[model samples]
Target chain A: MSIKKVLTGNHAVSYGAMASRVQVISAYPITPQTQVVELLSELVADGKLDAIFVNVESEHSAMSACISASAAGARAFTATSAQGLALMHEMLHWAAGARLPIVLADINRAMAPPWTIWTDQNDSLSQRDTGWMQIYVESNQEAFDSIILAYKVAEQVFLPCMVVLDAFVLSHTSEPIEIHDQEKIDEYLPPYRPMVTIEPGKPIGYGALAAPDTYMEFRYKMQRAMENAVEIFEKEGKLFGDMFGHSYDLVEPYMMDDAEYVIITVGAVTSTARVAIQELRKKGEKAGLLKFRVLRPFPFEKLRELLSGRKKVAVIDRNISFGHHGIFYQEVKSALYPLSNRPPVFGYIAGLGGRDITVSDVVDIYEDMKKRETLEEIIWKGVKL
Target chain B: MVEIRTHGRGGQGAVVASKILADAAFRVGKYAQSFPQFGVERRGAPVVAFTRIAESEEELPVRSNIYEPDHIVVLDPTLLSIPDTFAGLKEGGWVIVNTPELPENLDIPAKFRVATVDASEIAVKYGLGSKAQPIVNTAILGAFSRVLENVIPLSAILNSIPEEVPVKPDANQKACEEAYNMTRIRK
Candidate 1:
């Protein structure tokens, strides 16, 4: 039985934590993510939620608190954004390397060059090197579902998970999200049965320095677990589909089966792209949208299959890769680098620093895709020519 | 899916208000989400957070700003004049603002449902604080409870406030209960 009420993306995350019956939560007060901690604290205080809400001083300490709690066999959660996320950089790798199945909601805020705290993918996207499973959600419901699924996926794969919801755009925006039943969730996810436990009786040493000879194997094992998570994500997606009657894939295609020119994007831009494609189709352009939900795995094989026959493909990236192009677009072009019937890949950078990317931007990308006779390695959108 | 937007500054607990609303909704068995839209603005910078509660599937591909909101809860009345805050507000949608009196000087679209309360004054009166940053979120919520049908029960929201925070459990809860009984709604 779902109730009808209005809630923001941050609240949805708290609801997700509550539904997951999160054992421990700790987060510092950052602009976009502060609400998440504020609400969680209230829930813990009111007895609406049964969890230990740690009052941490900074985002770094917050993640540290969650990591320690998770290592102690608790389902730990936390939230952060932008500089706060950057502060957690070293520990992010540490948490994943230690194989603590902690789930965090990173309210995606742009790092300051010009001192802006608006929405952008750079903060989390830049952390791709960290051995964590990352998922960018497009809507409020996805934010809720992603957190719940993240715990299950991380625990199953023995890795940490970061669920990225674009700060302000998705984070502050309100939308309806279906909250799962506690009984249903418990049925789906049993109590936290940690594969690795640290107890006084057992006395396990975590984060111990390894010898040079054995460090490679530890790193190799972490990589292996990430590879394993691809399968785990699919399995969990299947189970969530079975329980909720809605299915989400690593990649979601919108009218792309017959698309001659496909526009690839991530996050909320995909929604605007979908609307743009619909309007474009009415005008007889074979435009389509491929929403990349799973960014960390970099669905190379799927991209190859979809890009094989397209005349021109454009990648709309919200986060830049400095000298090259959009991070996801660079990965997409690389994925198609080995294909025989590879389409000409064009990458466009838009919506940086939380600047609103409207449907017009999507149309501009599709229109560029249609007009290009030869492909350039990259094309920047929303840039002054 | 009904979209909701909240307007306040960074220190105002606008974000907490959304989450408490979400918690109450979830308690009654509804799907809810809350998030904050903030910029470089610190304590005094205007911030907006949102909430969406619905009975069915939440459509993906959301926008940053709330267009056609079913409800808009403004924690700071000053924000009303600073921007086109109500530019896309839906006709007949509810607007619960924390103001002493409905600003008669401003051009308010006629079709909107309006409710006003001096939440800051109430907060001070109840010993919330001289600044009254935290209590407004709860007072507006309690007033919202009275004005918006099915928003949340006062008991549920009161129950949702933490017993630990002296401001929330004692003064904040009293502020909400008082605002709930006192606020007048003009449709």
Candidate 2:
């Protein structure tokens, strides 16, 4: 039997973690992400969940506790947002390179300069080379489901994974999400069996200092794990789908068949794009959407196939690389660079902070894609110039 | 889809009001979504909350904040004097305000369908106030349900009251019922 409840995306993630039977949780509170840790703490205190709630002074210590618990062969979890995530920068690399299967929830909030707490992808996108797998979610259900699936993939690849949700958009919004049966989840995900442990019984030295020769091999091995992770991601996704009657892929195609124009977006924007695409199609225009599911593996091959057929592919990003264009647009262009017959890729940046991006904006994007050809590097749509 | 924008001061249960309305919609088999705009706001500071009710979960997929709302609920009528409170309000939309005065005392637009209720009096009667400030969120919802064309059953709101408001659930239910019965609608 499935349990259905109205929950914010943060609470959905918390429910997912509890259902996954996380053994240890240590996190410092942050805006939008505070509810996640707060609810988890409640569950622990209520005796509804069996987990060790570690009190930490800062995000750095929270991650360190996660690292220690994971290294000791336990399923550890933590959550943070914006500056809090930045504070865990050092531990992020240590967890991934150490090959510990720790799962984290990063509520994607904008970085502070003038000091604003709002939704944006820049925070997580800036950590592109952190060696942790990043999976962005669109809804509360996706946030709940992805965290569980992420743990399975992380454990298999021996790499840490971060399940990301947009700051206030997903993190604070409440939606009806179905909670999976604990027995079914138990059947799907077994207890963690570490391939590595720092126990006296094993009698092995861990994290020894390495010179150039040994350091290169360890780095190469980490790359190899990331490569395998791309495949393991799909495998676990399929496994979860079969059990839950829902499936997720790296690229979700919406009415893309025989479409001449496509709008590419990540996270919740894709849902609005779908509505606009349908509206365009009603007016006798061929328009579709591609929602990027996983950012870590990048899904370059699938991206090539999806973009090859369309005449124009417009990339809408909520993040920028400062001086350059949008981060996802740059990646899309690089992915299609080597293709002999690739469609034209246009970039549009909009809805930074918590600004609203309505269906009309998407309709405007499709109209722009139809009218423009070879032109500017990027169009700053909806931004006051 | 029916979009609602709620206006109130901090510590007035405005955010919790949105959540309860959304939960009530869910109990009645309608897809519901709700959220509050978070910032640094203390007591008596203005805050906004939003709720979306749709026939299907997929119908309410947009995550953007609602601007042109189909309905507006004002937990505090003091927001009426602010010029920006009525921005992006859809023409012919309903406006439910918690005030005891007749329609002449309100600065209500001629185009809006107005509903008025003495939520403060109900809150006072129930003793659900903190010192000088009385929380009228639940009481206003009572008026909202009566004026909302019965989109959701009153029982749903009654059932959600105890779960959402921990203090004085029975008294809050009484206040809500009293407001629902006494609400005056002027189209």
Name the candidate that leads on TM-score.
2
Which candidate leads in DockQ?
A: 2
For B41-143, candidate 2 gives per-residue lDDT tens digits of: 6899998999999989778887777888888888888998887678788988888898888656677889888889989989988998963699999999998
**Candidate 1, which segments miss by more than 4 Å at Cα?**
A1-4, B1-187
**What's model 1's TM-score?**
0.76
**lDDT at B24, model 2:** 90
True contacts kept of each: 0.47, 0.63
Could you give candidate 1's per-residue lDDT for residues A68-137 as a string of tens digits? 9999999999999989989999889889989998999999888987778788899998789998889988
lDDT of each: 0.80, 0.88
Identify the candidate with maximal lDDT.
2
Model 2: per-residue Cα lDDT over A144-180, one tens digit each: 9998898888888899999999887888888899999
**Candidate 2 local Cα displacement, residue A59, angstroms:** 0.8
